[model samples]
Target: MTRLYSQPPRIDAGLFFLRFTGCLLLLHVHGLPKIFHFSEELTHIEDPFGLGPWVSLLSAIVAEVICPLFILVGAFTRLACLPIIAVLLVAMLFVHPDWSIAEGQFGWLLLIIFTTLAIAGPGRWRVGASQSREVRYGAG
Candidate 1:
């Protein structure tokens, strides 16, 4: 039977690349703006669930800014992805359901990237990875 996976080093490298690039794009495009322009974002953020604008904007900041930082460093990556995924899902599905695929391509693409990371994890290149390995596989 054919091998189902690449070598460890290659897989780790790919995971790191995906995490780094995806998180970086999210941080740069969405996270920083929400941070630097807090008041402006407050004015425009969608309150899809009628939770109020402050709650909505704060939720977005947590997901886009704080969560990406965790994912970027490969710590609690799967857990971190949950908020990002939730926020993107809300934005795409609830807040902007009228957007055509072309109009919403970026959000959809980010969803794909983060969803992939959530499934694949940060691989062996992650922070505390050695500790996890030692625990899971026994000391080598």
Candidate 2:
């Protein structure tokens, strides 16, 4: 009898795909609606932190639409997570702090995942990879 050995799967690819897909989904489900609607009701209402509606809406647009798009494309993935993390923190602290887990936990979970991606980055397979190579080798 011969024993065969297989190497463990690399998690980087899975992580990259998960983060990319998750960010895209979030942008579509949450970000796009807010951006497209741009209602006074949503924006005029004072932010949870009392930052006022305009600031809140602007921040939300930057985090949900702009930053998430960068994250999905793996362009500056780590840097892009900063605004998202900020938004999530604001939500957790002011918006949904008392909400039951069943009522709303996805935002919190996304915050954690985005934080993790910030630390791990977009992995080797990312737009950043090519940019990094170009920087290192000089422009073609």
Candidate 3:
């Protein structure tokens, strides 16, 4: 029998899966609930930061629904990350400044993750893969 080394695969597939799952989980756990549950509250509350409730609602919808959809499909992943990053920044500065580490840490983690996604962009298997290649090749 051929000698089979004991080492695991070298491709880091688990890392890719973890990143994708983490993005989806974050959007579902944090963003989706807030979007669905807080719609009325978001509409009525006077935004203290001068963004106003309508703008806040729009931002939340974009971040929670639109961005999460894109992230799940890995379509326009970098573009989708922008709204999430903005939302996290707002949350960090306005909403949870005094919260405990567990409560507040997600914003920071999202910031880092989204920022990285924005920089590196969606990987090879994303919905945008063809578009990415087209852009690189200057095709229509």
Candidate 4:
């Protein structure tokens, strides 16, 4: 019996798509709005860490914006995912505790994707620091 396709490459591509799509949407759709409204939200945002609203706002911006951008580029992808995951978790539990499963579906999906990337490693495509660590297996 012969398989129809090489599995590893397909799996790697799927992982890349998952990582890129999640991070890109979160960065532009969510993070950018927060950043652009930082001053207005600073005193009003939730502070789950007891660090005050301004600090929380900044931390959230870093997690949602900076960290996701790093993950999108595959630079320290695993490490970058940690902050993103943390932000999502806090949002799930505290900021939006009333969020129904349907409403929080995307958040849950991102949590799973980030967790997967954290474990599966950042696949074969990358730039900057992680480029050296990426390994490709070609059937020669």
Candidate 5:
């Protein structure tokens, strides 16, 4: 039996999977629809910080779409995940708590995943994973 942590490749693969899947969920399941329907959705989304729906929707699009795409390619994985994690926190803790705990739970799960990917990185299988790891961890 081989423990997953005994190898770097396993860790890298896990990171890659997490990075790809989590971001894909944020992009396709969440962001893409809103983006495609931007005109209608612009003022309909939540204004968590009272920033107005337009600003809020734009923020969500960036966090869930632009950043996730960066994460998907490992181009700037950690930097990308930061906005998403922040948005999730705002959504789960501040915004949705007034509505329902169930909604918050989803945010929490994604928060955990993004945090993990932010910490673990996109793995060596990714485009710039090695360089990112070195810059982030001070490793060679």
Candidate 6:
């Protein structure tokens, strides 16, 4: 008979799927465009905190581009999610507070995904998978 329980491998696979899909969607839709069209992105970049457009864009690039890259590889996965969560919160809650749920669904969904990953860690099947266990469960 086939088992229908969450085995370690199955859980790890699920985590990988979540990380891969979330990071891929974030990178392809938001991150890469920032790099490929830096000039255009700069013109309309939001400066919600009055940090200046350059600082805002660079911050977004780091959270959206660089951090996602780190999470994708499972390097500092939990730490990487913090910046993304912060950026998403700022964008959804502060920058575009007027956006209804329908309009901000994407950002909200990304928030949920990253938050889950942050709590769950990258799971096995990641680079330095064993180390991930140590970090999550504590070094022995």
What are the clashing pairs of model 2? Answer: none
Tell me how far the alpha carbon of residue 29 in candidate 2 is from the true structure, in angstroms, after superposition. 2.0
Candidate 5 global TM-score: 0.81
Which digits, one per residue and each the tens of the lDDT, describe model 1 over residues 1-140? 33333346788889999999999999999999999999999998889899999999999999999999999889999999999999999999999999999999999999999999999888888877773342233243
Winner on TM-score between 1 and 5 is 1
Candidate 4 residues lying further than 4 Å off, grouped into runs, are 1-7, 128-140
Candidate 4 lDDT over residue span 1-140, tens digit each: 33233336677688789889988888887799898888887868888778888779888899889988888878898898898889889999988999999999989888898888888767766664333344446554
The global C-alpha lDDT for each of the candidates, from Candidate 1 onward, is 0.89, 0.77, 0.68, 0.82, 0.80, 0.91
After superposing all C-alphas onto the true structure, candidate 2 shows an RMSD in angstroms of 7.7
Model 6, range 1-140, lDDT digits (tens) per residue? 34333336788889999999999999999999999999999999999999899999999999999999899888999999999999999999899999999999999999999999999998877876663233233233
Q: Candidate 1 vs candidate 4: which has greater TM-score?
A: 1
Tell me the TM-score of each prediction against the true structure. 0.87, 0.77, 0.68, 0.80, 0.81, 0.87
Comparing 4 and 5 on lDDT, the stronger one? 4
Error of 5 at 129 (Å): 5.1
Cα error, residue 36 of model 5, in Å, equals: 1.0
Q: What range of 10 consecutive residues in model 2 has the weakest lDDT sum?
A: 131-140
Q: Give the per-residue Cα lDDT of candidate 4 at 84.
A: 85
Question: What's the CA error at residue 125 for candidate 5, in Å?
Answer: 1.2
lDDT of 2 by residue, 74-103 (tens): 888899999999988877777777888766
Selected candidate, larger lDDT, 2 vs 5:
5
For model 4 the local lDDT of residue 139 reads: 55
